[model samples]
Target: NNKKGSNLYDYWGTDISDVLNQDESDLIVNLASNEYFKAIDKKTLKANVLNIVFKEKKGETYEVIGIYAKRARGLMVNYIIRNRLTSKELLKDFSDEGYRFNQKLSTGSSWVYLRG
Candidate 1:
């Protein structure tokens, strides 16, 4: 957790905003954990940030197991680096470590992946 009364936006909001506003697709695929990425002030960013959630299906429910979820996030980063994937569509091709994209459970900005 962040130190008491410490806020990310107060430290690096402008830098993050500038990066997002640069001449790239106005999309930010936020893979950072909730605590760390909060350093960026969303209002200042011109990019549309896409957040992905990973889950495991348990009987009648879906849940994120912390350790496995961390592994899954790393695997996804590995896949991106290895494949040089730029298009969001390529994200659907991710199957490393047994996770699969779940289209039926995804929304416009948030994508979900599941493994069971």
Candidate 2:
């Protein structure tokens, strides 16, 4: 089931130009969703997860294309990418036990792939 008022939906198929300019703390809070990210302490989450925001050049301006977060999981890695720019082949390369490239959260301009 999907939760309402979560940024998860906003992160999909939406331009994140403003989000890219935000501070690290604000960025994490903005991107956090109830579905996957349920941590109450933002500082703790920030310290634990490795976050990366991606951008792409669209004609003249650069647009925020994706957000990636990863945390250590013993020998493996737990990660998620809200992707609007990666090709299917490249996405496949990132697949792991928790997430498959084909098992995306949504269709169209963007997709959310989570691995836990």
Candidate 3:
């Protein structure tokens, strides 16, 4: 899963553009895949999905507090893939200074990291 260029589309079969273009409520109702979207609390799910769709509008950077692997894929797509940042660049920007990368996750899920 740490293969370079891997993204939400690769992990969840979800196209970021499609998710971004859809209405928020419509996305919430349609994105009910048990393998990925299941088991997430509704409020958190909505917030995460909306964050992906409207990230630019927020105009501020906030740390991803506690994202699971499935949720983290979307964020990787938003903050990494969409912005065309290489892994090295990501490390340069977010590593050290109290930000750690994949501190305690299994290898298979280590590609995702927390900013704070």
Quantify all predictions' global Cα lDDT against the true fold: 0.81, 0.35, 0.36
**Which parts of model 1 have CA positions greater than 4 angstroms off?**
1-6
Global lDDT of model 1:
0.81
Worst 10 residues of 2 by lDDT: 70-79
TM-score winner between 1 and 2, please give it. 1
Q: Which stretches of candidate 3 lie over 4 Å from their true place?
A: 1-67, 87-116
Indicate the TM-score of model 2: 0.23
Residues 1-116 of candidate 3: C-alpha lDDT, one tens digit per residue: 55533754354333443444454543322222334443343443332232221111122653333334335444445555556763343532433223345434313312334443
Please provide, for model 1 over 1-116, each residue's C-alpha lDDT reduced to its tens digit, 9 standing for 90 to 100: 55533565665747867776885786787777767777777877777888877898889888987778788888888888899988888998888877888999988888889988
Q: What ordering of candidates by lDDT runs from best to worst?
A: 1, 3, 2
Clashing residue pairs, backbone N/CA/C < 3 A, model 1:
none
Q: lDDT of candidate 3?
A: 0.36
Give me the overall lDDT of model 2.
0.35
RMSD of 3: 15.8
Best by TM-score: 1
Question: Which tens-of-lDDT digit does each residue in 19-74 have in candidate 2?
Answer: 33343542221233334443343333322232322223457754443333322121
